[model samples]
Target: MPEASPWDGISVPAHTDYTVRQVPGPTAVPCFWGRDRSGACLFILDLDGDHTDQYRKNTTTINGIDVDLRGEAGRQRLVLTLEEQIDRDLFGGLCSTLIAALGNASDAPTSLAVALAHIRRWKTFLSGRAAHHLTPEQVRGLFAELVFLEEMLDRGGTAPAAVQAWLGPEMSHQDFIFGNTAVEIKSLSGTERSTVRISSEDQLESLNDNLFLRVYRLSDLPDAAGARSLNDQVVRIQARLAAPEQIESFDRKLVLHRYAPLPEYDAPLLVVSAVRTFRVAGDNFPRLARSGLPEGVARVAYDIRIEALAPFECDNDLVFGGGNG
Candidate 1:
């Protein structure tokens, strides 16, 4: 527990939110998600208001334990900044606990591992629902917002284009169509912050039509993962496989589009199957496409380079955790 704000004393910082009396025992901090605060930590993770009065009257429990934001009946009423700082400290402690428990630097306990797995599962729920986009600076903010979100829940979301990993203008059915197995490419950039949504009938149609190609950040060398192109990725993967010590850096572009690398037959190879309607499996849920496949369905495989899937411009706000406070 933390000591309440000392407003009764002297100095005060402008951005401070509130103060609360220190309780005897320690508490676990909840993971934080969405906030209009951008990268600022001046406010509580999910709290939206500055109702000092509320702190003065209410008793609430974070997780399950009761917390009296207000100082005991006679003590100085709690301030908003006090509560904000306490929550911040809690969030930090939780991060360290999660990382260490996960064996970031050393071996952690099994219980912690299990707890982290659960958190990951829960985070997936949040990532699936994030309709909003994040900028690079916002994405890598020191708070590790997404990482925190993951610990809080138990699942995740994509950081599309952080490295300029966009849907390239080239796709090939020949690569995706493999004796009953389909593979579609789903890539991301090395430094992008926005998440790409894999929804919609057509999008789902493509995913259903072929196995998804989810190429993300992978590095075999010190600075190699920072490379930004399919060519770079290929080169790095090869170097690592051939001679790991020979490579210096490994920064490559992310790709998750449909593809196949067949060396036996290179002459006008088929990439796409004739099936117009198909099923779609994704990083999240699975579904079947409603519309027909692309034109000229006779080819077993078609080299349909990605022209453009489409842009998402939904007007709705992405409410995190169903906006639960």
Candidate 2:
């Protein structure tokens, strides 16, 4: 049996045109969580009036998600049916976000306005596919940056500034730079979790800025609790950005990172348990500096063995001096 929905107990007057509900979970959005009659995790929203024409004009495929419009006159419903081939975590997050923002509200005009705005944004993302194809390398790089942002939030950093300043693909070397500190994030997967890939010698050559290396050992565990996808992390970070300008900046950064508001990132689930940080300064840190490398090697990239670099390991908090990271 499906779990009770969060909107199950919400009551409405008999004369009301429609009401909203959701499948029970700790989700931040109002949406059904269980399988549909056809046995798929589904999301359904009921609008008060007919939206047939609107849905017909706006219907478009996004990352294999099928948007369907149903219901009779005087009451219309929008159903976002999920496909089995896409990443389930991202799909679920999309449903949760849309449902929570558009449904379970008494004000019809306000709900419709918000829904239209979101739809326009989605359309724009779909149209920009040619310009922003999310590559595997970009996904991994962005994932590292996201994990760092999550860590910063956990450490009580100012969210608006921290999230806005996350320079993932924007900067060539450092993933994030705040004040005089530059953080290089490397995410590694596979059974060994043994190597960190350095993109270029210049990445670790920033001598003037305080440097730190954040290593995330991530793996895909189908049943792991608290695992979050790139999209999931994005949502969590957006909640912290209270200022409009900060939120806009974060959105722009997402585009630069090739992270469209789509449900097919194929993004690895973050292993919150396997996060580690190390101070990359001093002689103990193992790296190839630009000045030390051979004159012929310009854009040198190499993998450093994790086991060999254990001597310089430090607590996660130590890199940020125990305050906001």
Candidate 3:
């Protein structure tokens, strides 16, 4: 016989205060269908209310999703509502993201934070604003972040601190920042890792500071059995954040990256073959800098040949794995 669906053989009990029905389809949590004060159908995801003080301040609305935190510690629930006209698949995708973020936990405050993050992403997506597409550059950048995260975790760094290093915005000259050190990552596809694009004069302009460039040479695998997606890496990182506040902070960072809660990254299987780290110091490290330009030259970007940069290439241990110390 075929496997039974999660929504199969469901029953609703007779209740006096409110009517509750099981949400349809597969889900990580047992969501319930119910009516809100407006008598509109709302899907409820229950959470432990242990630390609900932060969210109790106000109702935050991003896009169309309303993050309604209800009740105290023992009876906390996150109520989500949408128009009946919305597509079912999109709604289900949003729920899946919530489930992934909640990670089978009943803790209220922490779960609430993550749920809010997921909702924000979905709100952007469902609002019909997101591109629903991950460019090759974006995918490469995400892979680099994941690699950085893996390396940091392997070396016994705290998840909260490591996650804070992921500076994903376009404004940040570097991809990561920990303490006084900044790391700029460059990823190239295919075997021939020829050159890397430096986005601005400041990207490599930190002459006296602890700036590092991490390069990754990647290729796409066809039908690789053990391959993992971006979502998989995200789950791995999220698991390492032991504290509730840490997990919540991680989610916030992900939001800043403009990463919406999608079912999964639809990109190809990215495989990294070579990883190299270079300390961006000394005169031998050839590149453009603010001091090099005469004047009025800004937003300057150029490509650097990898072959000539051999002198600056150093062991990955120098940057990660506690070699920097």
TM-score, each model? Answer: 0.20, 0.61, 0.82
Error of 1 at 210 (Å): 20
* Reference-based lDDT, each prediction: 0.26, 0.62, 0.68
Model 2 whole-model lDDT (C-alpha atoms): 0.62
Worst lDDT 10-window in candidate 1: 246-255
Which order, best to worst by TM-score?
A: 3, 2, 1
Runs of candidate 3 exceeding 4 Å displacement = 1-30, 33-41, 57-59, 104-106, 126-129, 191-193, 264-266, 321-325
lDDT of 1: 0.26
Model 2 lDDT per residue over 1-111, tens place: 865443344454355433434555432223444345444555665467766665654345565566666778887656666677555665655655655434323343334
After TM-score superposition, the amount by which residue 303's alpha carbon in candidate 2 deviates from its true location, in angstroms, is 0.6
Model 3: per-residue Cα lDDT over 158-182, one tens digit each: 8778877777554677788777778
Highest-TM-score candidate: 3
After superposing all C-alphas onto the true structure, candidate 1 shows an RMSD in angstroms of 21.4
Q: Pick the candidate with the highest lDDT.
A: 3
Ranking by lDDT: 3, 2, 1
Error of 2 at 162 (Å): 0.4
